[model samples]
Target: MTYMVLLAASFGYVFLKAWQQRNVAFDHVWWVLPTSYAMAVVEVIVVTKIVMTGGNWLAVFVLGTGGGFGALTAMWFHKTFLTRRE
Candidate 1:
């Protein structure tokens, strides 16, 4: 259960942080600071869990899967919601 939640949260926040980065690049500061802080918090917890689990293979795989999905989601989200089309 814990791992499941963490898996979902890991990808969710990574997506958020990536989206925030794109926003920041375009001078969008409103959400950047908070997202940065949130990302830091999430990373700490995730890394701690991985280390504490003795680098479990399942955990590592989940983390990598989350990251890959997060990156792709971020790109899709930004293009779908943030980009201004001419």
Candidate 2:
């Protein structure tokens, strides 16, 4: 549905952008932004849905914190692994 389409489009955009900047060593990092944005959007949707269903704010806060940490960890790992060495 909409989620699937959004996922596909996000990944497609990442792939295209990466391909377009294939010559640059760190260009792939650009892909991470779109992926992160997509995930953030999904997280917001899930949180809103949960709130609408009368879920606790504590649960939403925990999920949001976890998601943010995961995204930061991913970005760190990507930078560590993909960046060119001196």
TM-score of each model, in listed order: 0.77, 0.39
* Candidate 2, superposed: residue stretches over 4 Å from native: 1-25, 29-53
Which candidate tops lDDT? Answer: 1
Judged by TM-score, which candidate is best?
Answer: 1
Q: Name the lDDT of candidate 1.
A: 0.78
Q: What value does the lDDT take at residue 47 in candidate 2? A: 49
Candidate 1, position 5, lDDT: 56
lDDT of each: 0.78, 0.50
Model 2: per-residue Cα lDDT over 12-80, one tens digit each: 334433433432455665665565566566556654555554656554454445445544554556556
Candidate 2, residue 58: Cα displacement in angstroms equals 1.9
In angstroms, give how far residue 18 of model 1 lies from its true place: 1.6
Q: Mind giving the per-residue lDDT tens digits that candidate 1 earns over 18-58? A: 88878878676776888788888888877776766677788
